[model samples]
Each structure stands twice: as structure tokens, then as C-alpha cells.
Target chain A: MRKILDKLGFTNTNTERKTVTFGDASVVSAPGGRGWTWLSVGFFIILWCLASIFEWINPIFWPPIGAVWEQFVFIFTEGYRNFTLLEHIGLSLYRVLMGFFIGCLVGIPLGFALALSRVMNRLFDPIVEFFRPMPPLALIPLVILWLGIGESAKIFLLFLAAVWIMALATRSGALATKISKIHAAYTLNANKKQILFRVILPNALPEIFTGMRVCMGVCWGTVVAAELVAAEAGVGMMIMVASKFLSTDIVVLGIILIGVVAYAIDVVMRYLEAKLIPWRGKS
Target chain B: MSGLSVRDVSMIYNLPNGEDVEALKHLSFELEPGELLTVLGPSGCGKTTLLNILAGFLAPSSGKIDFDGKEVLSPDPQRGMVFQQGALFEWLSVEQNVGFGPKMMGRKPNEIKAIVDKWLSIVGLADFGKKAIYELSGGMQQRVALARCLANEPDLILMDEPLGALDALTREKMQGLILKLWKETGKTIALITHSVEEALILGNRVFIMAPRPGRLIKEYSLPFAEQGLEKNTREIKKQPDFIEVREEILTMIWDMEEEIMGRQEGNNA
Candidate 1:
């Protein structure tokens, strides 16, 4: 156990022995953590290949990784349903972007205003709290009924999903700008406008960035659900379409694509958040 | 007429529990231009409350404060303040924080630069102008705070225990630097501290306040601040009068604090 722990970099000769704990699973060390993650994935793939090769599980029911890879290539090359994979990805991205952009544009300004003014916060807080808990999927039928299956209904649904997240984040950020900072600015002869823009806004950027990341994540999810409302193209639509034909491989492919794209977006947002607000919690 | 005049300035706060808490009571004083006045008191003596009133951040419940015979009703560029700790805008670079006062006053860029450079250099943070506030030590930050306040060229500057957070050596050094600046700039300064050494060493006119209904309990005039400029702190402190005065004031404050404790205990009984 000590040797294994030493090998995993969790302990050395100079330090006290300790168990490496990851949630409920305790191990000797975490040098194994990275290896374990890859090992598990590799193990699952090997099992899948063995099962498919031996006809242990019917290929139709549980396709091998090779089959899924082949289907993924096919979808990339021959297109899926009425739209190409690229086109499907692009369309979904555009709708989500548009909705997220609108949410930031409208919600951020409103949020800053709400944060600054107690009266405005009092007035809108109840309404915002009411809508914030609501899922975009729950609003689909009403949105579709009101605006039909056009792009407007879907876009609005995505907007509704994202706006509250961003607005709440922005509100919290602005409201939480340190009271001492405000006092400092005031004592420096800063008027109300200077205090609001210079002191309050810069300090609030980190929280707003956090809000945007959360808002983007929600927008991605909501766009997929919104695509369920009579959309011809989208990764969400591809998943829906493939599942209808029991094309489990295609469904798996679509889900993977969505996950990869969302992960990529999260990486970009994290990078931007760091670059834009380098002093976020440094102070 | 050129200096500040506080007449019968009092503050009364009605607590939520149907109790009237008088933070300050008819505190009247005159601060001559270019003179440094330090108020020394125990905790809860409304030292800070009085500073806040003088800053125009708080309106006196009664009476008035006049700066050059102008009613001081609100915070103005001519009245700058230095807080004890974490008052410097940590997000801003040292230069930005120092220049903030001039920038707010709509001074020309060149003028603001000159003022910022002068004050920053005066506070011995000449090389640290590009550094962030968080990058500085406690002493350096207070130096920056002092420079930031002085940059405004405020007719009067208020400091609330500005060196209270510094180490003893740093605090002593800062005291001398403050005196140098006071002599150089000739700005009226109203400072609050709990240190008898600090109050005696800095103020030509010193006032001590009583706890509870915070009133001016005692006042003194001394040549120590001037002597401090020409002599070493130890030399000045070695004087028999200095020792006697320090002990006298300490005893007064100790007695007041004990009285507060006794009353609390009596209530508990």
C-alpha cells in the first residue's frame, strides 16, 4: 500500500502517509486518478469490442465502438437527415448565440439598474424570482402556441432560459461591489455617475463573467429543448430523429457531438473570463 | 474664517429598541488652517462618528460645521479622508488611486499627473506608482492612502486611525512622515487615534473624548509636535512633562473604560 501510494505521488518518504480520497473511493494516491480515468474509458471500449466481436450482446442493441465510429464518419460525410452535420451544428449555434446575446444585452443593463436602485430591485425581484425557477422545456408548448414553430418561439425560449441566469449574476455582482470602495470613491470627490461607472462596474466584472458562463451553458441546453418544437435541423433534432428510427448509434453520436461542443464553449469562456478579469479574486 | 469651525455639532441615533443612543454631544472646536488636531479616546467614544460628521458624510443631528464660513453639508473635493485599512481601491494601480482625486475634480491631465507624482513621491511610493494596491505591504498601502488623500490638495484632510493597522515601527515612521507632510503642505488635518503617544506627537492641539455620550472630555496644547520635527522621538518623549501628560491621559481613559465595565457588571447583577 505504501509503495503504491508513493508511486501515485500522493505521499513521499519525507511526508506522513495518507489515503487519497475521491468522494467515496479511497486510494493510495492520485497519480492514478488521471490514469484511472483513461483506464476506465479504455476498459469500457475493450469490453464493448469483445462483446460485439463475440456476439455476446446483439450488435443492433449495443453497437461496438467501431460501429459507432463508422456511423460518426458516415454522418460527417453523407449528412444526417435533411441537413449536413456542419449545417445542423451551425444552425443550433446561431440560435443559441442570438438568444444568449439578447439575454446579455437586455438582462445586464436591467440587472445593473436593479442592483443600484433598491426601489427597482424591490419591484422586479419578485417577477424575476418567479421566472428564474422555470425550465425552458416547460415553456415550449406555450411558446409554440403563441408564436408558432417559427424561429421566434425557439429563440424566445432560449432567451428566457438564459436571461434570468445572466441577470441574477449581474445583479449579485453589482450589488456586492464593496461598500468601502464606494466610500473611497465618494471621498475622492467622485459624483454619483463616476462612482457607478468607475468603482462599481470594474469590481462587478468577475461576477458578470461567471454569470455569462452559466447563461451560455443554459442557452446551449435550452436551444436543444427548443429544437424539439418542430425544428428541421440541429444536433437536438438529429438526436430526436435518430432515436425515432432506433438508430441508437446516431443518438449516441449526436449526444457526444453536443457534449464536445458544450465542453469547447466552456473552455473558451473560462479562458476569456481569466483574461478579462485577471484581478477577479486577486484583491 | 479660513479654517473649519464646528459649533454645537451633536449626533443622536434612535435605536430600534426604543433607546436614544447619543454618539456625540455638542462637540465644539476650532481648527486653524495648517494646524493638526488629533482626537484620542477609548473604543465607542464616537471618535469615528465625529470624523464622519466633519467629512460631511454624515449630517449632524444638530449644529453646523463651516469650512471657510461655507456650510459643509456634503462631501467635497476640498475635504479628503484616509481610512485605516482596505480603504485604498485594491483593483486600481497605485497611480490610479492617487490620481483619482484630481481626475474627479476635472483637472487637466498634465496637472493631475504633476499632483499625483508629487504626492506619491512625498509618501515615498515614487517607485510604486505602477504597482497594484494589493502588491503593497500594510505600511506601503497606508502611504498610498495618504498620498491619495493629499493628491486632492484638500483644504483639510481627515484620517481615522490611519496607522492603527500598521506594525509599531511602521506606525512610528508613518507618524513622522505625516508630520513632514503636515508641515510641507500646511493643510488642516483632523485625525482620530487611540494612541496617547500618537496624539501627543502629532497634534499641537489635542482633544480626548469621553465614552458613551461622547463629549470633549479634555483638550491640551503642546509644543511636542514642533519639537518632534527638530528632535528625535525618544528625546521628546524623555521629557518629564511628556511622561506625566501621557500617564495622566492614560489614567483618565483607563478610569472611563473601567466605569463602563462596572456599569455593565452592575446591570448583569
Candidate 2:
């Protein structure tokens, strides 16, 4: 195994190995158990234990860590045998991704339009400003009225939440393009369309990516809100059902799942940003 | 039928609060073919305004910019400009930035490649073709900007203090390259600079302007027109008239400073 690991380029000759119980042997490092992550987990466990034994507080309101884990296992196995946690998570992810992509399709060009043309700015600025300030969740009732309680209404709500952020970011980014660069482009005899595509759009990509991140966060938050009203099979629906039954462990488990998923999406987006904007970070 | 002609050009800025500021007043100059004309002045002297008009980037409120007896209305590849900040596209590789002009003009890939390669060699950035703009030093970026402009094969090149951002050493190096390019290409060049020495060093004819409603004060022609100062800067410094001309230009600028200060004081009173 050690030889195979070395051949596969996993060898770390600098480290010393130590054998431990539970039939596990591992390399020992001085920094082990000294990181903030370990301390944070230890504190979380202590808090969970203390909160569980208080007894003065209702158990339904604050479940113990073990209880939450147990509920998570139950939901994965017997409790949700018909429809697993993964199924709910998959549905939620689909909704967010679909809405987010739709927002990008509409938002990026609209933002460029706002930057490039005064006529478009005048025509759309008032409507955009009015809608931009209102919360996307607030439009849920109107959306449902217009499109009914189907996937369309929920998707529309998510798109509405994400689009404004993307548009505003793109417009600002386009406007921030250096005049000198534009003049240089002009002197090169670049046509209007060429200048817009080659110079303006690529320069705005970094800012556009920033807007996409904010839009994603908003999309995630609004997905829960959209599901809260009438979702049949989503994480938000699971939490709402657990709330009514006073199942604190299930509620905690759902909340943890949502947080973890959101964190993972955020990490992925950050990685994408680093890859796409390699030039921006270098300077 | 001059290479470039500023035919009694004037510019007026209508301020947001309904006030009017006259930036340029009857600015007229003519560039003979293959002449390097440098304009020198204090800040707000419309040095840039004059260059912009000639480059067709801006329209004068009065008078006209004419090129080869035709009225210049808009920017064209025939009159290329190199800006002070390099103005390189950060996203493009060095070759792409240099090749941008030809590509946009719909030149064939082979033709564009030839032009890009030729200018890149002249600027001494031949090996940095695939590198990103941000990867280059300030001096290298400026050289790329030069290469980008030159690749278009412009009849008249307008530069707005193109080497102002460089350190003294880099600026001197760039000055050398500019003189070499001027000699080899023989392109009609109009460069705007605040540095009197820079104006004196590069220009065949130097036009010194007065600040605030900028108008040309005087034009001086250098005696050593064919001599390359980049190579013989020390010998030029040793010349009898070089120090005298430098001091004369310096006094002209100091007088403008006093006039501006006096105006400011009167406004306070």
C-alpha cells in the first residue's frame, strides 16, 4: 500500500508515522489538534451537551447533537425510504441552478445595454430601479397569481431575485471601463460591435462574476422561501414539516444540510472566479 | 495638402451649471510629412485637446481638423494614438493586443501576423507575444502599446505623453526607441508633453503654448534635424545652443505660472 501510494505521488518523506488503536496507523504532525477547526467542533459539542441537559428549555426547541445525527441517519434510511435526503437536495439544487442560469441570460445583455446606450438607460432605468429595491420574496404572491403554483412561479421568483443583482453589477462594471482603452480602440479603427465584444465585455467579466456570486446567494435564500409556501419535496419543505411535528432533531438536520450545501456552492463559485479572472488577481 | 492641419481650431466646454469655459482659442498648426511636432505647456493648456482634435477623437467647437485636404471627423487607423497609461487590454495576450488593430480592420490572419511580428521586433518585445499585459513591466506594456499602434501602419501617430508614467531610466529608454522609430518609419508624429526637455529632444519643430485658453506661443526648429539625439544625447548637451534653448523654454513656462498665480490671487481679492 505504501509503495503504491508513493508511486501515485502521495509520498511525504518529511513526516513520521505513528500507529494508533482502532486498527489505524497514520502520520503524526505537531499541528494536529491545534487548529481552529478542532477547537470550534469541541466548543460546538460542549454547547450542544449543555443545551440538551438544561431540561428547563423544551427538547423540541433545541435538540442534542446526537439526536440530530440520529434523525439524519433515520431520514436517510427508514424515515425517508420512499424519498431520500439526497432527492430533496437534488430538487433544491436544480431550482437554484435553473433560476440562476435564466437570470444570467437576461441580465448580462441588459446590463451592457444600460452601459452603452443612453436611450435604453432612460427607457429601463425607472422600471429597473422600482423593481430592484423590492424583495424577490415579496413578488411571490403576484408571481403565483400570474403563473399559478407550478414550477414556473417558483422559477420566476428565483429569476427575479437574481436578475437585478447581475444587471446592476454588469452596468457598473461596463461603466468603469477606462476611457483611455476605448479611445485606443477607436484609434485602431475598431468597429462599434468589435469594441463592445472584444474590449467592453471581457473587461466587465470580473465584475459580472461578482454579481453572479451575489445572485447565487440570493437564489439560494429565495429557493427556500419559494419552497416554504408550497414545496412538496425539498429541504425547505422538510424543515417546515418537522416544525409542525415539533421534531427539533429533523429541523436541525435540515438546517445543517442547507448550510453545508450553500457553503459548498460558495466554495465552487470562488474557485470558478479564481480560474476565470486569472489576470485580475495577478496585478 | 499637408500630413495634418489644425485649421484655426477652437474648443468650448459647456459646463453642467450653464457656464462656458473656452479651452482652446484659434489653435492652428501644420505637420509636414515625416516631421515630429511636440507641443509643450503647463497643465490645462489644451495640449491634449489639440492632440485629440488632430487624432479625430474630439471635434472642435470652432474651426476644423484637416488631413490631406479632407476634413477629419472621426478616428481612423490612419491616425493612431498611444496614450500615457499604455491602455493595453489586460485580458489579451501581448500579440493579440498588438494584432488588435489589424484584426478589427478585417486584415487577413497572415497579413495581421506579419504586421504584428514586425512591430513586436521594433519594440524589442518579440519573445513576449503570448504573455498577458499585466505580466509585463510598465516599460514593456508601453512598448506593446507602441507596437499595437504602429502595427496599423498609421500615416500620422498621435501620442499623449506616452512615456510620462515611466521611471526616469525607462522614460529615457523609450525616448531612444521613439527617435529610432521616427527615423525608420518617417511617420508624421504629434506628441504632447509637459517636459520641455522631452519636447526639445524628440521634436523636429517644438510648439510652446500658453496655458488657460491655450494658444501657440512660438515654434522653434532644431538645427540638427537628421542627428539621432538618443545616440548622441551627451553630444547634443555639449552643443552651445542646447542649454540656451532649454533655459528659454523654462522661462516661458515660469511666466505662465506667474500669470496663473496672479489670476488666482485676483479671484481671491
Candidate 3:
């Protein structure tokens, strides 16, 4: 057990440690952390391949890696249903972006109002608080009933997923404006409008960006789920259709696509955040 | 007539439990134009409250402040402030931050740019005009704050321990810069600080206050700041006169703090 622990890099080195304290252990010894990420991913793929080849989990349920790859190529070439795979991806992206943008447009201003004014907060606080905790997926039945199973219902669900998060993020952002900054602005001869626009708005951007990133993630998850419940076309619907026919390879392919797309969106959002708000955590 | 005057200022904060805390009591003082007044006190001495009232950020429950022959009801551009830290806008570039005041007052863009350039050079941050505020060091950030305030050409400057966040060496350097600016601009400055050495080095007039129903207890008119302009502050500190005064004020503050601590311990027992 001691040898195993040593091999696992958990050796009892405390006895041999120097008496003097050093700087942060994590920063001092984050050796090859990025390498570990790649190593874990490589190990998982190898294990999956080995399990499939050895028939550890039945092929029908597990679907070999090659089979999933073949399904991906088939869909990429022949398309899913009447639409191309790209088209399905594009359609989902469109819904998410449209819903997300609209949500931001409306919610950001609402959040500013709620943060800046007592009356607005009192009027909207209960409604926002009530709906904020509710999952957008839980609203599917009502949304479908009201807007039907068309694109509007799906977009509405995505919008719901985004709006509350945006509002909350923006409100906190505005509220987080330092008292000194406002006082500084006022003493600099800035009027109320100038203070709001120049000081408060810029101060709130970092928080608003954080909200956008979180809201995007929630909306991405919600869009897929909404599609699964009612849509005729989407990555989620494609997976649903594939599973009905026991085409586990296509189902696996679809799931992979969803994960990949979601990850790609997040990476893009992070890049944009870095470009726009370089002083975010530094300040 | 052209400087700041505080007449009978008092602040009482009501606690949630229905008790009232007298933050500042019957504080009255006058700050003459071009005079540098440094206020020193132990914690809870209401020095901060007094500074806030002077800046017009907080309204005293009673009493009034008059600046330049006008009743000071709110924060005006003519009275600028420098907080200890984090008052500089991180999102703005150094140039933009310095130019903020003039821009807000609807000055022409060329005039604003000129003001920013002049002040940045004066603060020795001329090369850092386009640099983001967060990219600067703590000391550099304070320089930006000073430049920003000066660009407004405020008749008076209020500072709340502006060098408190800096290292000892940096604090000394900033103290020199502040003295130079005070002599050059000749603007009335009221600075609140906890450092006895600092108050002595910076202020032509020093006001020391006591805690618990906070009010002014003593005032000293000193010549160190004027001497500091021509000689090193370190050399001045070594002088017999400076050392004697420093020791006296240190003991004064130390006794007040000990008394407060003793009272708290007695209450607990």
C-alpha cells in the first residue's frame, strides 16, 4: 500500500519537508497540468476502444468507435432526413443566437433598471425571483401550448433559459459599481446621465460578459432539450429518431456533435471575453 | 471667502437596534485656499465621516459646508477627491481617466486632450497615457488618480489616506509628489491619514481628533511641508524639532487607542 501510494505521487514527504514555508504550492508545483488533461482524454478513448473490441459492453448498446465514425460520415454525406448535417447544426445555432441576443437586448436594460431604482426592483423582484429558479425545460409544456411546437416555442424556451440569468448578472454588475468610482465621477463634474453611461456602464461590462457566458451555456443545453421534446429537426431530434430505429451509432454520433458544438461555443465566448474585457480579473 | 468652511457639522447614525452612534459631533473648521490640512486620528474618530461631508458625499445630519462662497449641497467638480485605492476606472486608459472630468463638463475634445496631456506629464506618467489602468502599479495608479483630479482644476482636493496602500518607499516618493503639486497648484487640500509622520510631512496645518463622539481635540501649525519642498523629508525627520513633535503626537494617539481598548475589555468583563 505504501509503495502504491508512492507510485501515485502521494508519498509521505512531509517528514522530509523543509521547515521554512514556501510560496503557494499549487502555483509552485502545477507540473505538466496541461499534459495531464490530454493524457486523461487519450486514456479514456483507448479504454473505450478496448471495451468495444473485447465486447465487454454489447455492441448494440455501446456502438464501436468505428461504427460511430461511419455514421458520422454517412450523415455528413447523405444528410439527416431532408436536411444536411450542417443545416441541422446551423438551424440549432440560429435558434440559440436569436434567442440569446433577444434575451440580452431586453434583459440587460431591465436589469439596469432593477439595480438602479427601488421602485423597479420592488415591482419586478417577485416575478424574476419566482421564475429564476425554474428550469427552462420545466416550462416546455406551457410554452408548447402557448406557442405551438414550431420554431417560436423552441426559441421561447431558449430565451427563457437566457433572460433571467442575463438579468441577474447585469443587476449584480451594476450594483457592484464601487461607491468611490461614482463619487469620483460626481466630483469630476459628471451629471447623472454621464455617470450612468460612463462610470456605471463600463464597470458593469465584466459582470455582464460573465452572465452572457453562463446564459449561453444554459441556453445551449436548453435548446437541445427543447428540440428533443417537440422539434421535427435538430441534433436532439436526430438522436431521438436514430434511437427509435436502434441506430445507436447515429445516436452516439449526435451526442458527440452536441458536446463538440457546445464546447466550441464556450471557447469562442471565452476568446471574445478576453478580447473585450482584458482588465476583468486584473481589476 | 474663496475656500472651504465647515460650520457646526454633526453626524448621527441610527443603529438597527434603536441606539444612536455619534460618528461626528459639532465639528467646525475652515480650510483656507492653498493651505494643506492633514487630519489624524485613531480608528472610529470620525475622520472618514468628516472627509465624506467635506466632499459632499454624505450630508451631515446638521451643520453646513460652504465652498468658494457657495453653499455646498452636493459633490461639485471644483472639489475633487482621491480615495485610498481602486477609485481609478480599470476600463479606461490612463489618458481617458485623466480627461474624464473635463469631458464630463463638455469641454471640447482638443481641450480635454490638452489637459490630459499636461497633467499626465506633470504626474510623470506621460508615457503611460494609452496604458490600461489595471496595467499600472499601485503607486502609478495613484498618480493617475492625482492627474485625473488635477485635470478638473478643482479649487480643493480631498484625500482619504491616498498613500495608505503603498509600500514605505513608494509612500515617501508619493508624499514628495503631493507636496510638489500642492506648492505648484496652490489648491486647498484636506488629507485624512492615520500616519503621524505622514500628517507632519504633508500638512501645513494638522488637526488631531479623538474617538467616541468624535470631535477635534488638537491643532498644530507646522512648517515641515514647506521645509520638505526644499530639503529631504528623511533629513527633516532626523531634526530635533520634527522628532519631538512626532513623539508627542504618537503618544497622544497611542493613549487614545489604549483607552478605547481598555473600555471595551471592561465592558466585556
Candidate 4:
């Protein structure tokens, strides 16, 4: 029965197993693990197909996978609301990148100031602590009120999302520098400027990269949500418009696209981090 | 006056609860140029505090430190320090780390490279200069630290349990390298260690401290360091005189630890 089950693919027969013993006591067999990510995704798609075929959910609420695919193809070829799908993605990415870059530009210096100088920390720490906890989405109404419902408003919202996180991350990074490293540098005849630029800055980089990754994620999320409330062209606007017209297929497609794009951005950021800061956790 | 001198140096830490902790008290010592001095004591004996003060990372509550006829006020290029571990800058490669002091001093790139190369080879890390600090083992990292400190050509070097993190085999090997560097460079060195044998093997003068006020209790002038420079350190460890001194120091520290333990228990009672 076991052999038959293995032949039927009910068991992972190809996996290699080895028993590892610790000291003179317990031994446990562990299999060489491989990810089954795509398999689980395929299974979910099949389940969705079955649900649609059997009318397990209302078709309007949960459209057939075929309908979503057709919407994707149509948007890819014929365009949507006078802009190509790529154009919409590009416009959204442009806003996120601009806000993220500008936020880091302002926030990283502020973080360094806060960390290095007691006066700066005392002055700005309360303001940062105040805004860091408040969600960027909560500021949408205020941002629109100040800047109006345009690119500036959306970009401003994203900036707000990224700035505080980057600032906090940079501050912690600078503060986390080991005292011995500073002492060693000082004893080696490093002046204050050299210590700040060489020792402190480099020491703070791994933490700053971590902050950047977090900032990117928050900015991506904020851009989508901001577009849902305002903006003429974006993935979130596209989804909102489709939902208003009850075109669930386009809505589903937009949601999936958002998830895939966010995942891709995170993966790229992780790859960059590994390449730039190879000694991150090793020390 | 020509080398390094500590006159009645004392460090008192004021606790938040309005109490005073005397970390070091009336610590007086002198290390001449080319002398290797190793400090040995149990925990809370202010050995680290003394090293820190000598490195100019700390100012004693009262007392004075004079090096090379100058009062030591702050950390200077002339006084280099080596921590036990995690003091290295991981962001820089071994070469960059070794060249840091010179680079900071605005030396030419070529000059810095030459200094780095010379020291890297001295510490036996010549080939590993380009490697990131994290890629190296514990012993290799300490070697880089040593090279980095030596590359600066400091007048004095302060080491705080530099080999404490290494395994027994690596520690022994590093001890030999340290002795070689000391002999060749002729720089005054003050090293702190927990091991009595290490103190005996490394120091021309082994300064022993006692806690409960953290004062110097004993000082021994040993010939083992000079002898080890010529003979094997391991073989020197097996010598009759070396064993005798080791046992004596061990008993001294053991008694101090027991006394501290008794005092703590009495305080509780």
C-alpha cells in the first residue's frame, strides 16, 4: 500500500532523508527540503476554478479565472481608459520612487543629526515619535486638503509614509555603533569628521538598508491606497473604477498585479541589500 | 618619565542610588619603552578600567598618567588599543581597516598601502588583507586588529583580553605572534589577561591586582617572556620556574575570589 501510494505521488519518494544524532542521545531523521511554492499556488488556482464551475461563490463576487485572464489580455492589448497597462504601472512606480527617494534624502540626514547631536535629538525626537505611529493613510484627507487631489497629494502621502520610518531606522543604526569601534578610531588619530564619515556612517549602512526596504514597502502600499482615494491613472485607481462599474475581473487583475509588483520590489531590494552590505549580520 | 607612568590613578563610579563604586584605587605603575607588562586579576579588579584610563578613553576621578613626558589627556595616535573582540570595523576590508589610521592622518595612498602590507605580513594576514573582516575566523580577526593597531606605529599598545575569545590552540599561536611583534617593534605594551600562565608568558613584569577597592597587590618581574622569545612558549610553560610562578599566582587569585565571595555572602546576611 505504501509503494502504491508513493507511485501515486502521495508520498515524496524522491526526497533524501538522513538521521542526525546530537551528543549520545536523541536522533532524528530529516528530509532534504525543497520549496513547493508553485505547487501550492497551482492548487489554489485549481480550487478557484472548481469553485467557479460549481458556483460555490457568487460569480459576480468571485469571477471565473477565465474572465480575469480575458480582462488581463484585453488590458494588455487594447489599453484601459486611454492609458496602456504598462503606462499605469509606470506612473504609479514613478510616484513611489520619487517619494521614496526624496523622503530618504531628507530623513537620513535628520536621523544622523538626531543620533549624533543631543540638541537635534531633543528638538526633533518628539515630532518624529508623534508621526511615526500614525498611519500614512490617516493623513490622506489632510494631504489632499493641503496639496489638492493630484500627483502632489499622492506623492506627499507616500513621502509621509516613508520619511518617519527611514528616520527612525537611520537613528537606531547610528546609535547602535559600538563604542569600541569609536574608541579604536579615535586612538588611531581619527578626527571627529573622519569618525563620523568613515566609522559611524559605514556602521549605520546595514540598518539604513533595512530601513530603505521597509520604507519601500510602506511607500508602495501608500501609493496604491492614495490612488484609490484620488488620482486619474494608477493600479489602485483602475481597481476602484472597475469596482464602481462592478467589473470584478479587472478588479481581481489589479489586486494580483499589485501583489506581484510589491513582491518583485521586495525581492529586488533584498538582492541589493545582500550585494551592498555583505557583512551586515556577520559582525 | 621616558616611557609610561601611572601615579595614584583612581576611578570612582557614582551609582544612581547615591553610592560610590571604587573601580580602581591608587593604581601606580611604570612601564618603560620596550617593556611588556601584563595585568592579571579576577573580575571587578579594575584591570579593564585601568587599561581604559591608560588608553585615554577614560579620565580617572583623580590621578595622572604621563606617557613619553606628556600628560595623557585623550586618545592619541601614539596610544593604540586592542579589544578582545567586536572592535574591528566590519564594513571595511582587512586592508582598509589596517590603513584606516594612516588614511585618517592624511597620509598618501601609497604610503598607507605600504604600511598595511608590512603589518599584514607581520601578523601573518598578508594574503587575507583583501578579505572582509567577517569572513575571517576569530583568530584571524584578532590578527587583523593587531595589524591595524601596529600599522599606525603607536608608541604604546593597550590590549584588553585580546585572546580571550580564541580557542586554546589559537590563543597559544597568537601569544607567540604577540611576543614576536613586541621583540621586533620595541613598543611599550600593557596587556590584561585572566590566565596567570598567559600573564607570566607574555609580560616582563606581571602586575597582579586585588579587588574590594581594586588596588595593586603584587608585581613579579619574570624572565619567561624574554626566554619565550628564544624558546617555544609551550616548552617554557613546562619549565620548573614557570610552573612554580603559575601555581603561586593561581593560588593568589583563588584566595581573592573566595574572599570576595565571602564578603558578598556576609553582606547578604
Per model, the share of native interface contacts recovered reads: 0.58, 0.84, 0.93, 0.93
- lDDT per residue for candidate 4 within B1-269, as digits (tens), equals 69999999999999999999999998888888999999999999999999999999899999999999999999999999998889999989999999998988889999999999999999998899889999999999999999989888999999999999999999999999999999999999999999888999999999999986989999999999999899999999999999999999899999999999999999999
True-structure lDDT of candidate 4: 0.91
The candidates' DockQ values read 0.60, 0.56, 0.83, 0.89
Clashing pairs in 4: none
Top-down DockQ ranking: 4, 3, 1, 2
**TM-score winner between candidates 1 and 3:** 3
Report the lDDT tens digits of candidate 4 across residue range A68-116: 8998999988889888899889999999999999899999999999999
In candidate 4, position B131 carries an lDDT of 94
lDDT of 2: 0.85
Worst 10 residues of 4 chain B by lDDT: B23-32
Highest-DockQ candidate:
4
* Worst-scoring 10-residue span by lDDT in model 2 chain B: B223-232
Off by over 4 Å in 2: A1-34, A46-58, A77-82, A281-283
- Model 3: how far residue A55 lies from native, Å: 5.3
The digit string of per-residue lDDT tens for model 3 on A187-244 reads 9989889888898988999999999999888988888888888677888889888888
Off by over 4 Å in 1: A1-62, B234-239
User: Per-residue CA lDDT of candidate 2, range B140-247, in tens?
Assistant: 999999999999899999999999988988887788789889989989998999888788888889999887777889999985445654347547756778789999
Cα deviation of A278, candidate 2, in Å: 1.5
What lDDT does the true structure give each of the candidates?
A: 0.86, 0.85, 0.90, 0.91
